[model samples]
Target: MASLAGCLTGEEESENTLEVLHGWTGGDGAEAADALFSAFEEEHSDVDLNNKPIGGGGNENLDQTVSTRLNSGDPPSAFAGWPGSNLEQYDGVLGDIQSDVWEEAGLEDAHVEEAVEACQFDDGYSAVPIGSHRMNDLFYNVGVLEDAGVDPESLDDVDALIDALGTIESETDATPLAMSLEAWAILQTWTVVMLSTQGYDAYMSFIEGDGDESAVRDTFETLEELLSNYINDDAASVGFTEVNQDIMSGDAAFIHEGNWVAGAYINEDLEYGEEWDAIRYPGTEDMYGLHIDSFIYPGDNPSPEATATFLRFAGGETAQVAFNQYKGSIPTRSDVSTEEFNDYLTETIEDFEAASEKPPTLAHGLAVDQSTQSSLEDVLNNNFADPFDVDAATAGFMDAI
Candidate 1:
């Protein structure tokens, strides 16, 4: 693997460095991101690659780091991020990589239908879709649920879910549901709760800025109930990475997260259906919440050639397959085979195909602009999570979108 030229010492000026920024800083995510980076490095041996990972709840930490760099006029050659309406924030600053990366990767014919409009920006593509994640997934510890006498299938709606939470609390000592009160995670949970309560049309309408106040209030009320009584007492102090692992440790029974968290369950030596498993987040069975992560190509990128090469690899079958194998996601390319994927991802792939509708996820920049996402994050972090202030949080959410 060659060294990228984006950030270099005096001796490395001759090499072309492509500093690639991403959020897969720890655990299985780091391994998955490494697979993609290693494959790209092997294919483009002449270019130096600098890997920058900002770790936290998904993009919670990464977005701010990228924003700080962008404000300081130091954007990476390419950064891993979401596509779709989220790209609207960087409209003018992004380059048209359609000809170099998109055409070279032959993405038009090979990628999934959802990948088409998602990568579009300024008459060309802004990023390359490597993997697709279903955001509305609730992973549970098989043993904990069995001990609590809770059936995942019987819990179909928010009310049933809360009842199960109570049953788990009363029957066992484990935290009923694991949670991270980080702004992004809270906001993510809030959105899914919104989806669970109101259905697909209303959920879509909410992110599009046409949401009903009653729905917003209702979502917050549920959030308050769950966070207040069902979770661990230390939820606010713990981060996502820690709480997610609680299921495997028998400290928690359930966690609401995307498919990415499943990789950790496997890494813990847990089987798909026996030790741990995932279920459709209550009420989201009819819909697939798309969490698309791509690599953003900035217009003023320093290592243009390296960036193109990296993007080309990112869009290829090799990179996607290797990454998603450990990333707990499916390749965006429809032609990519999933024989190597584990049991969980195989089922996720099937669910994606059979789902009635797939909407962009709001919590991770899929459903709204940067301003709205940031605003909601601030609102949730400042007013909602700790206090569980339903009315204020509802008002803040409505104003943000």
Candidate 2:
């Protein structure tokens, strides 16, 4: 079990200890975090860093645990989190790190535009981003596309994509798109559908809470058709990992997911650009849908100096490169080089820079607050997935968000 006691503000037993709560207990996430932790320990040998990893996809369990600790006046010195309004939940407890970390660590100039935007609040900076995951990725199996005589590069728009799905269904035995009906999965696909069909401005308007009802209905209609027609038969029963498996085995042609899916491919020893590939979601080439994993500074900090050291390390170029290599994300620092990463990451780094807009993803708590995320998830997955009700889904989204 992880310790509740935080770092040494000279009052604690472990005077040089620093506790960090994160959700990277297994697989590539764990490996990537271990690399980061090892590097930190190597640099700061005096401080005993308590690495508390709470296992859960999307930090579902970890977030609640951190909240409980913070409420009990036992906040970790630093904790991993998403950027944007997600930080507002812990507003009272989160301390201002603008001068301590942002300015001191040179993050203001080094980090990407979206990272800076997400980290800043009216009062002060809420967090410092460690990595950036592009959420608008459509991954596909190379051999399946080749055998079906369909060119992945030719899919320039939703119409082209729909026609290609038809071509894959008719010409090959592979499933057109691997999917899932798990609430988060449904919400994830729905977000992509909105971007691919409604375009960037419409997607942004919806995320910001003043969505156009007609466009919302239209996006819902498009998602309903895509989920109803092209996805694998077992989509309702499977999840994201299963979908990745289906695509890699050539049983499915495509799966729309975040760049974190790259870690799975890397784990399997699959070659990028040859065995599989990812593209900017059709109709979203100009927009980079981003999901950032960051770290927060808490007000109940046991060791302010220790936490500052940790934050400074996290924001450094060396640490960013080390953490993101296996974490399945690109460095939030734009200065980090792509030569150290795989082809997919290198391309994503370029795409992120060239894109006109880097919009935070909705399902992952980057674009909206935690409440809004839960509301949308419940509204879409429960009302739309099983029933495929566009009117109800649109109505729920229009009201809830």
Candidate 3:
């Protein structure tokens, strides 16, 4: 309820001082970003807020922008980001958010704890949790499942889920799953499979390894098997836009996507539970589809008032409701309800709550550090898109990082 607008004075108040640069171009991404800015404007009417959305198709890479700005001594007051061990990159540059504020906001649950731990740097400060969008969820057409004699709710294990896939494929001419060539999404699908099979320990060990030859070998082998078995018809060729279109129509029965898919469904005027429902991707009995997304406040930030205002407004209950509702993500605050979501979303929430005790495995995109991200991104794009020498690709990825 505290307004950052109050911290400013006279001439500067109406100056439209804060320019937020983010990658929230059209679609639900744009709507969600706009909603967040609207909330800020409502609270601080005098502050001139300029929203400069960067990139399209989720191409806005905040890490690149943040690095450029911080090095140039012109960092934004606040910027969008996710927390992982790589948060250590900020070191002295990132600020320690007020713990009392996060706690009072009711964001100290186990999931929040996991996110904080992932985001925390050596100094113990972290990028504050804003909202979470569950990626790697298997969203499917409920009607299609019924037609295939597959029980949408009966997919309790990986075998059963795979079997259901086959049934759907045989019964309908549509693609059983709609996946994209986007490196992040492809890598996410791989991570979900890896995490589901090996669990969190193996994943952590491999990532933490100093390019262990054997570990890298096993990971690549697994990747090959996954691409060959589950995916259909040159999946490596489809781009993000094409994949979403496949899902939007009845061309595809399922798509491994993040919560943002809900926006596409809403855009199509389709109702959840009736037309579609999302289930935790198979092989993830221990882990639910939980991913943390947030904003990191630079430690050396000169505009304390603006940064404080941004963080406060972001975590506030009002902002949580507005942003999450529009973004089709779960509110970071536990006290908030998902009443706005339809039956399918409620079911997804139920699954997330049930698996709350299980530590959320970091989606691969945000799990590894920056240096490692580029390397892995290269591997994903290469292995998925082209017929590369697997052994060379594996070694190259490990070496590149």
User: Which residue pairs in candidate 2 have backbone atoms (N, alpha carbon, C) closer than 3 angstroms, thus clashing?
Assistant: none
For model 2, residues 106-161, the per-residue Cα lDDT tens digits are 88998878789888865788688899888888999999999999898889988899
Question: Superposing every Cα of model 1 onto the true structure, what RMSD results?
Answer: 2.9
Span of ten consecutive residues with least summed lDDT in model 2:
1-10
Off by over 4 Å in 3: 1-16, 57-60, 99-111, 122-126, 156-159, 210-226, 229-238, 299-302, 356-366, 388-390, 393-401
- Candidate 3 clashing pairs, residues 3+ apart or interchain: 16-48, 93-299, 94-299, 95-299
Cα lDDT, all candidates: 0.85, 0.85, 0.65
lDDT score, candidate 2: 0.85
Question: How does residue 241 of candidate 2 score in lDDT?
Answer: 75
C-alpha RMSD of each candidate structure in angstroms = 2.9, 3.4, 4.4
Among these predictions, the greatest lDDT belongs to 1
Each candidate structure's count of clashing pairs: 9, 0, 4
Instruction: Give one digit per residue, the lDDT tens place, for model 1 in 108-191.
Output: 898887886789898999988989989899999999999999999898999999999999999999999999888888988887
Write the number of the candidate with greater lDDT, choosing between 2 and 3: 2
Model with the higher TM-score, candidate 1 or 3:
1
lDDT for each residue of candidate 3 in 98-180, tens digit (9 for 90 to 100): 56335444444523455556556655544666677776577887777777788867877556766777888789877777766
**Ordered list by lDDT, greatest first:** 1, 2, 3
